[model samples]
Target chain A: MTELSELHEAPAPSHAGLDVGNVDELHEAITAQDKTRIRELLDLDLEHPAELADRLEQLSHSDRKTLAELCPDVFSPALLAELEDDVVEDVLPLLSSRQISRAMEELESDDAVQLFEELSDEAREEVLEELPEQERREIEESLSFDEETAGRLMQREFVAAPEFWTVGQTIDHMREQGERGGDNLPEKFFDVYVIDAHFHPIGYVPLSTLMRSQRGTLLRDLMDTNLTVITPDMDQEDVAYLFEKYDLISAPVVDADGRLTGMITVDDMVEVIQEENTEDMLALAGVSEAGLVDTVADTVKARAPWLFVNLLTAMLASSVISLFQNEISQLVALAVLMPIVASMGGNTGTQALTVAI
Target chain B: MTELSELHEAPAPSHAGLDVGNVDELHEAITAQDKTRIRELLDLDLEHPAELADRLEQLSHSDRKTLAELCPDVFSPALLAELEDDVVEDVLPLLSSRQISRAMEELESDDAVQLFEELSDEAREEVLEELPEQERREIEESLSFDEETAGRLMQREFVAAPEFWTVGQTIDHMREQGERGGDNLPEKFFDVYVIDAHFHPIGYVPLSTLMRSQRGTLLRDLMDTNLTVITPDMDQEDVAYLFEKYDLISAPVVDADGRLTGMITVDDMVEVIQEENTEDMLALAGVSEAGLVDTVADTVKARAPWLFVNLLTAMLASSVISLFQNEISQLVALAVLMPIVASMGGNTGTQALTVAI
Candidate 1:
């Protein structure tokens, strides 16, 4: 399949991936109300089944209503794992509380934590009450991590073998583990952390190196010593930079006690990069935040403060114009040209800021 | 091989494909030269091979110095493509005339035209004289297109097939033609333009579509009728929007006669998106232009005029302060809070302007 087609058909779990086909199809489906075709497409067994499930979930509520209620079972946990927080929130309410609890149970600690974060306080409490005791503890424990830190971002599902294992054994273990029934595992991962007997991550083996190397290579011998251990408390931006600078696909996030907690993957980092880029662009523009996906009232509420501040600045500029009113009256050219100069200056300054920032 | 590794070693032709590895390696290499890496990375790659070729050919005797002789081939075509017009003028003379001619031949016509536009009268004549007649004619013809139009930005090298061709035949044709080798073939293309007997582009098939489709499918059957055609006179900004709005990988660029002349691809659009974004950012910041690779001098040059304009604006704001100077003399608190209000408003205004822009 073409990358574009794959991109469209198989939505990446992360909000970062652009499904051009889904976007187009969704647009068409919404306008035309092609519910039958949508249902057919939804039922089709797909290679990236999780992605397809998410796409179906993301379809308009009106569209989703047309599907049989039993269809929710077809929604994969990975699809739930891939959705945006706001999107998941919207979808969660549509599902039976049992389904919501099950999805939460199926999620890795970080994903469950995020899903919990997006819930209404009452719904969250209800969901927390419904979750199995072990699941609830994991969610609550992850919640203790600072927001927008590695702790919050990393997925708790990870493969780490003891340092004594041979590369062959590690691979075999992972393969054997796969044969056992597990409902949800990351469809892709890039590294295996080598841990001490006590579960302290000592080093890492990039999957690429592991795949190419001899099976008999000891995990300890093969692991990269110059490894980056992300502390749970470290900021997500710093995490992004480390990933970017080191070309890390996935890195282990450790607690203060040096215990491996979870892993942060490149796909997540890609979203962070795009989010950060949007933030920089918006911030440089003077927007308060990026992705103001809340209701229009919230968006306007967030946006208006900046506008009000701008009004004052504009008034300041206006006062400058008012000061030169006499000068402008005497030489209207100054008034006409003054704006040109200011406009050009604003443009130029923005350009400089664009590069510098 | 992983996409990241391929990206690392691919010799990225444009900044559009610049992966983290290149930036990191370049950062390290610059630091290894016993220079502050950040400062060095911030500067233009002026002595880049393609630029050096352009420079040695264009510079007058005595202006060429030891620095000019120490140029490196590692300097990229992309770097030269991004040089400021003024900087291009200053450096092109250091290049060998033959090298200049060869580099021009190697560059996309749009880039060659852009470089040609920056040359001095004497240098332009000398360089043009050295170029192959057909190549020179093509560049000159491209120059005839309005600046910042699709005609100027479009790559002439593209794959087009008659609508009657089956998928197998089209693939065979491309493979055979690639073996034969000629200028008409795009170095890389995202689509195959399907043309009618009259050579008017009827539809397009993304290379991915072409690769995935059944061999017996006719080109006409596979082609997407939802085509976004670019007229030579169309503005580049409008062109950028079409690519973005349609999620187009590539589209046919037509001449005044409505006949296909070239194709514009997403990679090119990606550069345009970045450039336009940079332009918007710089404009908002009151800077003239924020070319990422600008030298300190070039930066200062882009910035100074805006800074001067800002000085005048500041003075205008200062005059407001002066109006309140007497008030300030009476109450120092007025001065302090006055800055607060102005500062707050400035920040607010920037926020609004950023969103608007």
Candidate 2:
């Protein structure tokens, strides 16, 4: 097993153990279009998709595309899921519609929808046509909901049991379904929603609760009835807030008639929390989103608009100071005091804004 | 069933559904020290610890003290766990050592250590003496770890099965443990570490996987050997990064000898992520931590030193401008031009700092 090399480990092999992450070596491989070296470099990271995506993100635009074309098989669905949306948009156009469609089909619906969202309009149309009707409809329904809503963020696959089921019956049902699994059940789920005959969730049983309970215990008796039900159209931020407030591992999402439609897990909420926090920080600094792989032009585009606003505001302030030029010519002391007064006000104003934000 | 009302509801009850969270009502009840009214107010919030903690945090300091006195029984271990560190520090002195020791015994060791850390040094000695020996040792062991390390953040209560055990035997072991439960297991856990004879964590299985697998499958066959083991000395921030990178629900914490000592779960990691992000945002503004319950004096205490430094820098700049005052007296245009150049450079410097941060 690889050591988690990025973490602050005790002096072990001088921190040079993660030589596989040396992007300079990969950059040369990409520059020379050396497929063998590229494959060797990638093999080290194939098991760690996020690390592979990070390497791809650090490469130049042309080099990344060259690497992708040299080993198109390296761009697995898991690798695609790990990539930044901005990077995915760059890479998606290079692959065929059949390849993109296959990846979407293989991924969880929530991730599939996100990847599909980044495709060009024409590519989306082509991919949708190629997809199975059921898969295509699932993607369309998720897209129908607004971006950053629970409907879009939730995975269509989940575990639910009826209220009348016993612990033994529930296990049997899940085991039989597991044997037949092909997107029928989520890869991981913490809570099994206890639902009524109408498929409306009444409560949830954590898997731990299920594991510890006797086989004959009824599902209703084991579940905590004070379930925090989430509506599909709820904002992702609010859904995240619910998860944090309740310390929930997963919550069932309901549709208009209060029937269970999907499930939203904590792993997705982690990403949303980070995204929201980054936006909050950037907003305070008067800048918009800027990703690592963003070009110099893109960085300039994001920062320049905010700087221009500050410049206009500064010019307006300076113009007012110019109005005092006559008074300053007679007594230069007035000019020094004036800047001091204005500067004090500006600093205090920003400090207040920072704390309030 | 209380609706998750703070979430955008689809016009259920005109958004007045969470009137139980009304601070004005609680404030009046608190100020009166009306025990009956306090109990009634507390009853509404009993099911939701975080909401109850939120109300306490919003009350005036004096009113809060009065309320705590009126209904000390309301300060449950779960409620204390939900509270901010600042709030807990203020409330610790009011409780008896026995009451505190009982709470610590009931809570998971991670939360117990956190609450124990906030006690007055004298109170810590008193509480430790009152606690049962094993409980005392657990808290003391956690306290020995540096603040915000994996050792401090992880709870000692985790499930581990021997490598030779089958799924059926493991479930039977958990069921037997459950029948004898007081704190033998965590209230919730997502993974089970499969350990070797030497008690080193070799791999793990998610509870979901265990639920779906056949009864007779060996844990060694079911476990994922590519486990991300966290050393107790690892920074909590780095541990949280691992969680996010791998989408881990929980991971085993090991000692220098690689023996599994404790488990850190995703819920704790979520809190750490938020705390780290908040610190990042505050550092950008040159301020320290300020919580909701902090007084005006405390707020000023956190913010003043940075402003003082800014003040010294401004005075230095003004002194330089004074040296040019003689030339400015002859040419008034210099006065206006000086402010413009200085102001422009200052804004650009701050903008660059914001982006860099």
* DockQ for the candidates, in order: 0.07, 0.48
- Kindly list the per-residue Cα lDDT of model 2 for residues A84-180, writing each as its tens digit: 8998999999888988999999998999999999998999999999999999999999999999999999998999999889999998888888777
* Candidate achieving the largest lDDT: 2
Candidate 2 lDDT over residue span B306-352, tens digit each = 88887887788788888888987988777776656666676777667
Please give the fraction of native interface contacts (Cα pairs under 8 Å between A and B) kept by each candidate: 0.10, 0.46
Residue pairs with clashing backbones, model 2:
none
What is the alpha-carbon lDDT for the whole of candidate 2? 0.83
Q: lDDT for model 1, on a 0 to 1 scale?
A: 0.62
Query: For model 1, how does the per-residue alpha-carbon lDDT over A131-172 read when each residue is reduced to its tens digit?
Result: 889778878878888888778888878878898899678766
The residue-by-residue lDDT of candidate 1 on B250-280, one tens digit each, is 6787765567788776555545554666577
lDDT of each: 0.62, 0.83
lDDT of 2 at B242: 79
Model 2: how far is B300 from its true place, Å? 1.7
